[model samples]
Target: MGSDFYQQSILPFAGIIIKICRAYTHSQEDFEDYYQEVCLQIWRSRDNFNAESKWSTWIYKVALNVCLTHLKQRKKGEQQFVSDALPDEVHDDAKAFGSDELNLLYNAIKHLSEIDRAVILLYLEEKSYAEIGEIIGANTNSIGVRITRIKERLNKFIQAQE
Candidate 1:
């Protein structure tokens, strides 16, 4: 049952998990840990899904919540020491979405408040304001306003990098 549910449900939405984890983590090790936690969480919460929203929406919420919690825990000093050097193997996420501009954008995103990071990541994925609101627990109206502001802040950060 677990294998079947995983193949059918979790595997299909893995990209969403990957993207969210990438946005919330700085290093490859942290990304892998967050990805595993998110998958475990989605599996554990499978029975709790009431289907009020799409499965993808539920997955996003789980992934974001896990990452946010992980971030907070790290701030409290659960974080491990990592070197400043890049990993030998290019990150799969980086290879898949690699570009200087995207790197700059991601660096800018890291500066956002947690909620703003989630909002902009979903916006980049082209999720509708309604869907984003459903995932992030914001109203659709606020999602629109937040996205506008996030974009403005992102533009300034990116320009400053030039």
Candidate 2:
């Protein structure tokens, strides 16, 4: 991507992409791969974004979709090797959440079904149920219900860890 495009289009929303990528990836390497792929896809598909929604929303949708697609294409029944190092973009945000807590949360999130994972990630990012519903193709009511269930599941997972 050109410096101008990155500056004008991708730079402002890089955090959104990194956050979504972190949720969907297991290791720093995987996160980097997904992040690069998302950037490329965004540049390639910029024409499809018609300003119907916020740029952040479009980026979120694209990043989640790309990560989900990458996960599906990987071979099944294999372990995801995690590393301690966080990408620079994610490090500051992860610190805000507390690394251990964020690790536990993201690890729990990884177990959710793809769509449920997307919903919960958006919810964590403080997106409204209506906005998350629009991105994930669910209604607001369903987004709320799914988020409740996802939280219950996550609580159980965290408790089990403790």
Candidate 3:
């Protein structure tokens, strides 16, 4: 990766990448691996971006795809990484409630279907349905419906934990 490219392009969007990595990975090591891979992919695929959307949107689309691909490759029943750190992107109230609650939330999030996980993550980031649809290749209406279902499922999961 060119230094100028890293400085000018990737660095500005690293936080979004890191947050996505944290949401998808189980442990610190996995988070680091995903973060590195996403950054590398961004650099490697930089030329593929056609400037059809905001750079951040393209970065988010790439990051989510990478994480989803990595998750699918892991063997079922294999060990997953877990930690008490607050998930990287969430409301400040989540931070104030403490890491234990956040950990519980993360655990619940992990139980969701992969697409639902993506939907919820984007929702948490406050992306509009149209933006999410563009990133994930779903229609805006489907994204809305999925978000409703994901919220209901997450609520049930959290309540069951209590």
Candidate 4:
């Protein structure tokens, strides 16, 4: 019984939740707190899931909603993390991402307003425009336009870094 649910449910979505939390929250403690909160939310909400969409889609909605609400409370200004002192695991992820691209991504993301980052994060994870809109309470057509500009702006931001 113990291994059954883990094998069926938790294992599949854990990495996605972790990555979403990481992308949304810069502070380590907050990230862990929110990640756990998301897990609890998932467990509680699982029964309500109707499966009209894929399981991944439902999980994304719940997890992203949790992150957005949490991120909305953060301060306005962006906080920069100096690469040198980052812990080995995070440091390795950054390094493996390649300095140039990773720096561009971090700079681009850090520059986004909290909500915009949430939009872009879900979009990047390949959520459909309708799903993105539903998650953020926008129309699908509008979200499609916003995503295009967001990608362009992200590119410009990367260029600014270079």
Highest TM-score among the candidates is held by which one?
1
Query: What overall lDDT, based on C-alpha atoms, would model 3 receive against the true structure?
Result: 0.78
Candidate 1 stretches with Cα past 4 Å from truth are 79-94
lDDT of 3 by residue, 68-127 (tens): 877877655443443344334323432342478878887888888777777787888899
lDDT of 2 by residue, 13-36 (tens): 877888788888787678777877
Decoy 1 TM-score against native: 0.87
Minimal lDDT window, size 10, model 2: 78-87
Model 3 residue runs over 4 Å out of place are 76-98
The CA lDDT of each predicted structure is: 0.84, 0.81, 0.78, 0.69
Better of 2 and 4 by TM-score: 2
Q: Can you write out model 4's per-residue Cα lDDT over 28-122, one digit (the tens) per residue? A: 66666666667667877888989887787777778878877766645555322222233233434434534666646855886787667778988
In order of appearance, the predictions have TM-scores of 0.87, 0.86, 0.80, 0.73
User: Candidate 1's error at 34, in angstroms?
Assistant: 0.2
Looking at candidate 2, what is the lDDT of residue 11? 74
Candidate with the larger TM-score of 1 and 4: 1
lDDT order, best first, reads: 1, 2, 3, 4
